[model samples]
Structures are given as C-alpha cells and as structure tokens.
Target: MTPTIALLLIITFLLSTVGLLVLIWSISTNQFSNSQNAARTIFTPGEEGHSEDPAREDTSAYKGDSKAAKEAFTARRVQDQSSKPAVLIWLSSAVFWLLIGSFYGLLASIKMHYPEFMADSQWWTFGRIRPMHLNAVVYGWSSMAGIGAVLFLVPRLFKTPLRGTPYAVTGAIIWNIGVILGLGAINFGLSDGQEWLEFPWQVDFLFVLGGALCAVPLLLTCARRTVEHLYVSSWYFLAALVWFPFLFFIANVPKVFPGATGATVNWWFAHNVLGLWVTPLGIGIAYYIIPKILGRPIISYKLSLIGFWSLALFYSQVGIHHLIGGPIPTWLVTLSIVHSVMMSIPVITVAINHHGTMWGSFGRIKESPTLRFVWIGALMYTATSLQGSLMALRSVNVITHFTHYTIAHAHLGMYAFLSFILFGAIYFIMPRLTDREWPWRRMISLHFWLVAIGILIYFVSLTTAGWLQGLALLDAKTPFLEIVQMTIPYLQARSLGGGLMVAGHIVFVVHFIFMLSRRGAMTQGPTLFRVRTKEISQ
Candidate 1:
C-alpha cells in the first residue's frame, strides 16, 4: 500500500482510540447518569416551557407588573434604541451593497449565456464582475448585515447598555469605505487574482481595522453583562467574532504559502469563511429570532452544546475536502472526508433543536413575517449543510467538482440560508430600532415570494444542468463544445431567476427606506401578513 493510504489508516486508528477513551471516561465518571437532571440546567426558575418574548400572553400578563422584570425590560429596550444609529448605518449600507451586488451578479449570469452582452467593457467583463458580485455580497452585504445584527443582539442578551456606539458607527463607515475602494480596485484591474481574496492586501487591512473597531463594543458589553446565563446565541456570535479576523488575516498575507500549498490555503480560508464566519452569524440569528418570536426556549440546550462544539471541530478540517483529487496529500483528503461525515452530528443536532422548536408553532408562521422568513431560512440551513456533507464525499465530489452544481449549493447556503435569515432579522429589528412598524405589509410579502421563488428556480435549473454537464465530461466520447452547448439553456434560466431576485431586493430597499423615513400608517403591534380583526378595527 502507498504511504498515503497507510497514513490514513494510522489516523483512523488514532481517532477510534480517542473515541474509545472518551466512552470509557464517560462510563467511569457516570457522566450519563441523571440525564433528566442535567437536561433541566438549561432552564431558570419559572421560565421552563415559556416564551422569551415579553409581549406573549403567558409572559406579558403575569410578569408585566413585577418591578424588577419591568425594569429589566425597560433597560433592554433602551439598549436596543441606543444601538439603532449603528445598526441602521450597517444595515442600510448592507442593503445598498445588496442591490449593487445583485446588479453585478445578474449581469454576470447573463454574460454566461450571452458572451457579447458586455464584451466591449473590460470592467463589466465576467472576470471582473463575477468576483465583484462575490466580494460585494459576501463582504458588503452579508458581513455588514451580520455585524449589524450582532450589535443589536449582544447588548440585549447581556442586559447591558451598549458601551461603544460611536466606535461601532465609525467602524461601519470605515468598513463601507474599504468595500468601496476594494470594488473600485477590482473594476480597474488591480485584483490579486485570488477567488475570494481578490482585493489587494492594503484593502484587507482596512477591513481588519474596521472589524476590530466593530468588535470592541461587543466584547466589552459581553464582559460587563448583567445577566448570569449566557445564551447559546451569544456563544455562536462570540466564536464568529474571534474566528473571522484570524481567517481573514492569515488568508490575505503575502507569500506565506507558495503554489500548491497556496491553493490549499486559499480553499481552506474560503470554506471556513462560510462555515465559521457566516454560518455562525446565520445560526446565531436563527437561535434568537425563532424562539424570540415564538416566545419559547430552544427544545434542548444540551443539543445546542453538541451542535456548536461539533461544528467548530468538524468544520475546521472539512475545508480540505474542496481540494480533493488535487496535488495535496491523500491522507489530508481522507481526513477531510472523515470530518465531513462527522459534520452530520452537528447538522442533525441543530436541525432537531431549530425544527423541534417550531413543531407545534407552525401556524404562527402565517401571522408573523419574521418567523416565516427565519423558519424557511433555518430549514434551508439543515438542507444545505447535509447536502454539503454529501458533496464532500469523493464519490459525489467526482461528479460535482468544477461544475455549476457547486454554485447551486453555495447559493442554497448563502442566499437561501444566510441572506434569508438576515432578511428576517432586518424586518424584525428595523421596527424595534425605529419604534415604527413596516409601512407597507404587502411589500414585505412581495419581497419574500419573489426571492423565495427566484432562489428555487436558480437552484433547480443550475443543479440539473450541472449534473448533466458533469456526466458528459466523464464520457470519453463527449465533445467539449457539446458540454458547453448543454449548459446554455440553464444559464439563461439562471439569468431569469437572478432578475426576479434583483426585483425582490429593490422592493426590500424601498420598504426599508420608507421605514427609516417614517412614511407609512403607524400601528401598535408587530407587522403581520394578515391583520387581525382587533388590529384592523383599531
């Protein structure tokens, strides 16, 4: 047997030995004993089986007059209101970038099928525009929005007033300036030629600085927390804050890894960008929003612990799976595969906690727009994560590698999962920050359907076309031109889907501006798809 295969065997044996040791320790220490008692630790006095939302009947009526509870609620509201300027700055910038990114993305999608559409313009060429779309959405839209939500959430969770609002606002401005310069550089042919790391290294520094400034308040607020119990959401947020800057700095440094090693490092950073950075933000938002709206705790905090640690452990190594069949060591690839399979542990644990929380509360989806968007996003998280694990398998990777199928899967996580969760967060948080309801309820519904249907179409068409393309590439008799020809129709369909998504984004931006300007009928309750008789009459 080859040395690589022998190494793989050795590693597998070591992992099995570790597992055996852990099992033995569990038994010897009676860790599994009193399972019910351990499970009860997730709850506080009188809060079991209860909704966390103060507005919920179970909570509001009984606890409304309790002096300490009322005081805490008032303090929390003050923190939420104080963080508004910073959150608005970040989120508005995010939405603006969303529109710009959508334009770049739709243009790139169209150019795939119609090469002549913008052939004369070097700046609008597929080479530049595609990366621009990627950086714009990933950094400008998703990262900013996640930061905004974190700013809003950390203080509320800690029961402390936000300490560094001015710094956070400055950070938002600095971050936006960095994104602007980076995109301009990309358009002017100053790209680093790396996929996700296209922006020049100087530009990368600004992001690091801006992100550090943004992170200070969160860490300080967390440190000065009044509450004793740190929610699982806070853990995810804190871990992400720690993970992203390290990944960003290591990946962008010059001349560290050369050639094949550089390629491996690039993929490692790219994959972890989603897994550690964006995924945690999305999951953290879901952890808060789902239960906050439903007014209940997550089904199992024990499961949440398993999910978080398992994700951190397994996801870190799984990035190597993207480099399968490359010049990398075979043992590394095998290890990634093992970790990828183990990822199912966290994915399932999260799925159970999130979906289990929603079990009997499905009907509330219709009444509340925030829950509807977040629920669908949370469900997609499970779907995309499982699909990702399967794709990491060598068998599946052989078929889907270097194909548009990968694009479909990325969107299933990025747009369908993370973006949807952020969208829900924007909807929920905006009203509270502005102390105003959404101006147009119909616009919110329109925005949801357009993007939902658009992503469905985008994912389905590209996935089918990619599978066929992959199969054709494997056949010795298949001509290269035939493979290219097969993807054209799907590319056209992708453009159409992209168009719909862009329209949805436009509606969202307009609605957001209206809310910011206080332009609609003022109402007393949360905005719902269908207004109740009591609300309508009032």
Candidate 2:
C-alpha cells in the first residue's frame, strides 16, 4: 500500500518471473523426457519388501541381474533400512508431538467457545495458545511425521540402507529444541507477530541448521541410490526436501523485505509450507505406498508425471491468492487467482492417477488399513484441491475470505487430507520397521472412524456457519452482534468434534505405544476392513 511496500512487491514479482522463465527453459531442454525410466524404480533390482506371504523369499522381477549385485543390493536394503534404531526414535518423537499438538488444539478450541475459561493467565491466553497450537501441529506433528515416513520410504525405494542414523537423531533433538524455544518466545509475545512465521527470528537459524543436518544423509542417499530410474515418489521427496528449507529461510529472513511486502512474504511462506512442502511430501509418500500395497504399478503412471510437474509449476505462485483483496496490487492478485484455478489441472490429473489406480480394485480398500486410510486421504485431496480453486474466485473470496470458511478449508487439506495420509503411512511403515503387526483391530477401526466422523462434523459445520457469517458481514444492515450469536452453535459443534478427535488421538497413541513395546496380541496377518468376499476376490 505504501511506496516502499509497493516497490518491494514489484521486486519480488520480478524475481519470481525470472525464476519461472528458467523453469520453462529447463522444460524446453528435454530434461523430463523419461517418465518410463523414473517409474521403473518401483521395480528396483532386488527389493523383497513385497509379497503378502511373510514367509516367502523374494522372487524379484530383476532376477536377470548378477548374483553379486543382488547380494549387495539385498544387503543394503535389509541391513539398515528397516533395522535402524533412529527410525523408531524419530517416530516416537513425532507421535509425542502429534499427541501434544492435538491436546493444544483441544485447549484452543475450548478457548474459542469459552474465551474467559483461562483469561486470568496471559500464559494460557487465547492469543498465545492459538499460534502455539498451530506451530505445534504444522511443524511439530505434520512435518516431523512426514520426515519420519520419508526416511522409511527412501531406503525402500532406493534399495539402500540409511546412513548416519546418529546424525538424524541429533537433528531431531535440535529440531525439537528449536520448536520449544520458538513456542516459548511466542507465548511470551516476543514473536514475529505473523500467522505461521510467529517463530521468533532469533531461533530460526537453529531449525535451518537442524534441517540441513537431517537432510545431509537423505541427500546422500539420493546420490547413493543403485536404481537406474528414480521413482516418481523420489522426485516428490527430493523437491520437498529442497523446497521447504529454502522457503523457510527466505521467508523468515529479518530486514530482507520491508513493511506490507513483509506480510506478502509471511503469507507466501505459510501457505507454501503447506502446498510446496507438506503437500509434496504427502503426495510422494502416497505415490509409493498406494501401489506397493496393491502389489501393482500405479495405473497410468504417466499421469503421475503430469501431476508432479504441474504441481511443481503451479503451486509456488499460488500463495499470493490469499492476498486477493489485500494491500497488494490488483494485477498480482489477479495473476494469483488465475494460477489457483489452473492448479486444478494438477489436482485432476493426480486424482485420475490415484482414483484410476484403485478403480476396480476398490475391494483392496477393505483388506488393508493402509489402503483405506491412504485412499480416504486421496479422495480428500481431490475435494480439498478443487475446493481451494473455487474459493480463489473473487465472488467466492468476497464471501469466505475472513470467515470460518477459510478455517474449514485449511482443516480439510491439513487434517483430513494430509494427516490421513500420514496416519496411513505410519500404519504401513510401522509393520516393516518393527517387524510386527497392529495389535488391535478394534483400536485401528475406532481410530479411523472416530477421526473420520469428527473431521466431517468439524468441516461441515464450520463451512456452513462460515458461509452464513460471511454473507451476514456483506449485508451492511445486519448487526455484527447477531453474526457473533449465530456462530455460537457452530462453535459449540466444533468443540464437540474436537473432543471426539482428541479421543481418537488418545486411542491411536495407545495403539502406537503398544506397537512400539511389542505388547498385546499381534495381528497374524495384514489387517483390513471387512468387505464382501466377492468384491475382495475381484
């Protein structure tokens, strides 16, 4: 809005334009001419982490390769891939954060309905609690879990063992420290005072350092991979690894951009952390786990290629859409909206690949908890992406921008979509990691259904209430008090939903701890949802 801010925005836009031009140039050079080669990594030389029969030795597709190479590959794959102590350590940390964050979320939701419940203590104030809860969930549970999942996946995909387990453990320790320091800073009101960027700038360097340390071995693993073709999941994994730190440092750098343009940077960082960082991580993990469980290659694997590139191309520019009616230029906002709608191209292509992969094999969904959870996430991904594109429209934005509609939309993507994917990833990976099965079928079922029902209630109620709230705001004659009164019922409903979710999280934590301790009656086989025999047989 000011001269300085406008100038900063122009510079930012120009830099982005130059970056896009270079990307187009890379595309023109035929760098992406080999989808076949990339997809072939799924059938890497001697991976035996397959077969429904636990007792069966690998009858890998690459039998023609030399015995020595097979021996070396198998040695690498089994030696430390599933055996590493660090994997469990990181997972345990992730689970701790997931539980704590959900607890924080429950507290925040309570404050929303009953603001005076803890008004006496600034430490427990809503203002401080809300941001802390967000940071905990987004960075703590989601990002850590995502990293843990990919750590398990990369070795399996690359046909290699993880190196530097101690380094990763160190990184996790420092990362947790950074998060704690940041949370403390925020609660003390010594924050950057923006939504996702509230983590104090003083502590930002620790996270960057910690992330870099963790990334070192993962990047080395990418270089050390023996497979001829990098799988599509690897592509997603590599991009997210690179995208997140870069986004974090650039977006959080103090004194880099001034005033209102800083707000642009703030939002751009926050939303892209979702789109470019975690979204790719979830998609990459899904791309691997889905077909692996089905014992088949992804249907129309070429479509996966389209979706990957389109997402990379389209998503980075989309965060600006949140600034549609804000202090920025009209043209930039217009450009962002166009990109948001264009995002549907990637979303639809991904949906086609995902849904089509499971099209006739729908019954497989009934047989594997991994399949059901991941498949539900895939469906939610489609819904959330299309909803996002629609919400980017000016007519839609005018109604939903500042309302609970945005909150509902965010939960749809983050909780319903991403968390579901992460949940399923853990289920699939833990068996391989622990060499055991989920101990209780009922807990698994309860976890799935309770969270599913709670999120549905939370999303639908808030969405409906938000639309009405936004409409009321637009109606100049309507009193603001009436709008506040109207939201009370929906807020109460949200608290109920949040409580159900808390119960589910507790159930899942208990089950996860049982799995870790190797306690209780272990499942003798792959746990799956009950379905008709004919459908499963087909």
TM-score of 1: 0.90
The TM-score measured for candidate 2 stands at 0.88
Model 2 bad stretches (over 4 Å): 1-37, 44-83, 520-538
Per-model lDDT: 0.84, 0.79
* Tens-digit per-residue lDDT, 15-119, candidate 2: 789878977986998656775556545653433223221111121223214576456535544733443576676677778888888887888888887988888
Worst 10 residues of 1 by lDDT: 54-63
Query: Tens digits of per-residue lDDT for model 1 on 1-538?
Result: 4876888689879988997898799789875565444333333333334333321111122222346544554565677877888899999999999999999999999999999997997988999999999999999999999999999988877878888888899899999999999999999999988888999999999999999999988988888887656677888999999999999999999988899888888988999999999999999999888876665677787788779889998998888888889998887788888898999999999999899989998997776678888889999999999999999998999989989999999999999999999999998788767756677778889999999999999999999998898888889699999999999999999998999999999999999999889885554342211212222211
Model 1 regions lying over 4 Å from their true place: 1-63, 523-538
- Cα TM-score per model: 0.90, 0.88
Top candidate on lDDT is: 1
